[model samples]
Target: MRMQVDDLSDERVQALIMNHLESMALHSPPESRHALHFDGLRQPDVTFWSAWEGEELVGCGALKELGAAHGEIKSMKTDPRHVRKGVARQVLAHIIDVAKERGYTRLSLETGSMAAFAPARRLYESFGFTYCEPFAHYKHDPNSMFMTKEL
Candidate 1:
């Protein structure tokens, strides 16, 4: 699969993001869902990437610059039909590489603390992410979990 920077104006990317937000809503309460919308992801601090197998979009992920040496992972999602095929893993690896390229020393992410998110938590763990206290503007949330890794 090839990964490319996404402009967010692409219809396919928009659909994928919509699916991501909808999925998060299904697994977490409104206050616990932290998925960003198009406008949010389009912020100057965020770099979004979409993975494709030829013409098919397989997955997407983003890294948001939190500081000169810190970043946050956002909007990570794999197409429903493509789950378990290493799509998310590939995208995550790419995001980490980008963070390192940008000279970020730490990368963090937030996900739901629910059964539906167990797989995602395991995936992050495999990537060397460990449980951590909330960073950025987040607080202690019973339905949320924060994870981080040193680059």
Candidate 2:
């Protein structure tokens, strides 16, 4: 798959993001659903990427600079048809590479704690992201699990 920085304007990318948001809503309450919307991903501190295989969109992920040395992973989603095909893993690896290139000392992420998010948790764990307390503006929440990895 080819990974590229995205402007989030393509209808295909927009549809994937909408699906990501809707899926999060089903698994977490509104207050606990931290997945960013399209506009949120466009923030100055955030860098978004999309994975593609020719004409098909495979997955997407984003990195948000929380501070000069700390970064947060956001908006990771794989196309339903491409799950278990390594789309997410490749996209995540790309994000980590970009974070390292940006000189971040630590990378963290927030994901749902429910069963619906087990695969996501495992994915992060495979990337060496271990459990941690909520970072940045996040607070205590039973439904949220925070993970971090030192670069």
TM-score of 1: 0.98
lDDT of 1 by residue, 1-151 (tens): 9999989888998999999998988888898888999999999999999999999999999999999999999999999999999999999999999999999999999999999999999999999999999999999999999999999
Which lDDT tens digits does candidate 2 get at residues 15-35? Answer: 999999999989899999899
TM-score versus the correct structure, for each prediction = 0.98, 0.99
In model 1, what is the error at residue 66, expressed in angstroms?
Answer: 0.5
Q: Please state the error at residue 88 of candidate 2 in Å.
A: 0.7
Cα deviation of 115, candidate 2, in Å: 0.2
Model 2 misplacement above 4 A? none
lDDT of each: 0.95, 0.95
Give the deviation of candidate 2 from the true structure as CA RMSD: 0.6
